[model samples]
Target: MQPSHTPHVLVVMGVAGTGKTTIGPLLAARLGVPYAEGDDFHPQANIAKMSAGTPLTDDDRAPWLDAIGRWAHDRAGLGGVVSCSALKRGYRDRLRAAAPGVAFVHLTGDRELIEDRMAHRKGHFMPTALLDSQFATLQPLAADEAGVEVDVSGDPTEITERAVAALAHLAPPQ
Candidate 1:
């Protein structure tokens, strides 16, 4: 188990296939917090749109982001991890507005690698063709954002270790 630290939520974010769903629960387990799958917050209509290979417009995403924001806000100081494709600055901003202290873990990787991973993954609605749109929409965390950028180059354990290490400073005193 991890040593005691402050209770703070983590939003594991990145484009599809970056392993947010896989690594988020691992991070939460290590930190001894609950895990929320962000995809679950999407309305069926949103899923249908994605399933049709249509990228969601900002208007289409508003309610979904708000829902995730509410979840994050509710978990404040209770310590939780949630997976979100927080791909845009505006999206991240909406989350921050809802939960001011929520920290992000932006997973990054090469596009080709991500495409291959997506192609092989089963039972996911996000089509591989949309990866380009996600990349286009992604605005890397600004220097002032409260988060870390972990490269998605290794196994999940190694990546989690890196994320944990990177977030060490954010942890409160025991």
Candidate 2:
């Protein structure tokens, strides 16, 4: 399918280790758009909190979420994809406020698989110990949300293909 003219801002969203980082770029490439890694927008304090195994309060997350939201708005203006762990309804709402037409692609999987992925992963601030809290905080996207949910337990390429195809359907005709 050809790229759409609509402001195709896709947020690759989920709890940690759900392949947002892996699939986001590929999805962007498939759509011929740029991509942003949401983690880069987090403040050092927030990173430290997660690294220290403490969950961030909404107060702590608001600024970080706003930063990501602003980035999404900017990119949506130019049409792009973004990887974000927008774990709560409020967070997603904030993102929507910034980018009105933004769509989310939620990657979900079994907790065991996600925990295993987190345990073996490296150089990320969020620890596996925090997985439970992450899951606790996660308010999965509602059915009416403007996006698709893809099971990410399979191969990365397959997950990317699924996300790409889903986004393709949502994208406006070229």
Candidate 3:
């Protein structure tokens, strides 16, 4: 088990296929906090749009983002982890507005690597074809953001370990 510390609230932010779903839970498990899957907050219409290879408009994502933001706000009180495709700085900013000190773990990788992973992924609504749109819409996590950028080229365990290590400062003092 991890050493005792204060709980942390983090959003595993990235484009599809960046392994947010895979790594968020691992990080949560390691930290002994609950995990929230961001996708579950999406409206059916948004899922249908993405599943059909259409990118969601900002309007379409407004409620969804608000929902996740609210969740983050609530979870922060107890400290938890969540997976969110917080692709833009605005989206992350909204989350921050909801939960003042919430942190993020931005998973990233090259197009080739992400596309390769997407091509093989099964049962996910996001099509590989939309990867370009995701990339196009992405605004890299700003230097001033409260978070860490993790490369997704490694295995989930290694990636999660890196995230945990990077967030070491979040641990509450004994």
lDDT order, best first, reads 1, 3, 2
Q: List the residue pairs that clash in candidate 3.
A: 6-172
Score residue 5 of candidate 2 by CA lDDT.
Answer: 65
lDDT of 2 by residue, 45-139 (tens): 99998989999999998998898889877876578888888889899999899888788999999999999998888888888888888899999
Alpha carbon lDDT of each predicted model: 0.91, 0.85, 0.87
- Each model's Cα RMSD: 1.9, 1.9, 2.2
Q: Scored by Cα lDDT, where does model 3 land? A: 0.87
TM-score for each of the candidates: 0.95, 0.93, 0.93
Any residue pairs clashing in model 2, and if so which? none
Off by over 4 Å in 3: 1-5, 170-174
What is the total number of backbone clashes in candidate 1? 0
The candidate maximizing TM-score is 1
Considering every candidate listed, which one attains the maximal lDDT?
A: 1
- Winner on TM-score between 1 and 3 is 1
Q: Between candidates 1 and 3, name the one with more favorable lDDT.
A: 1
Rank list by TM-score: 1, 2, 3
Off by over 4 Å in 1: 1-4, 171-174
- Quote model 2's TM-score: 0.93
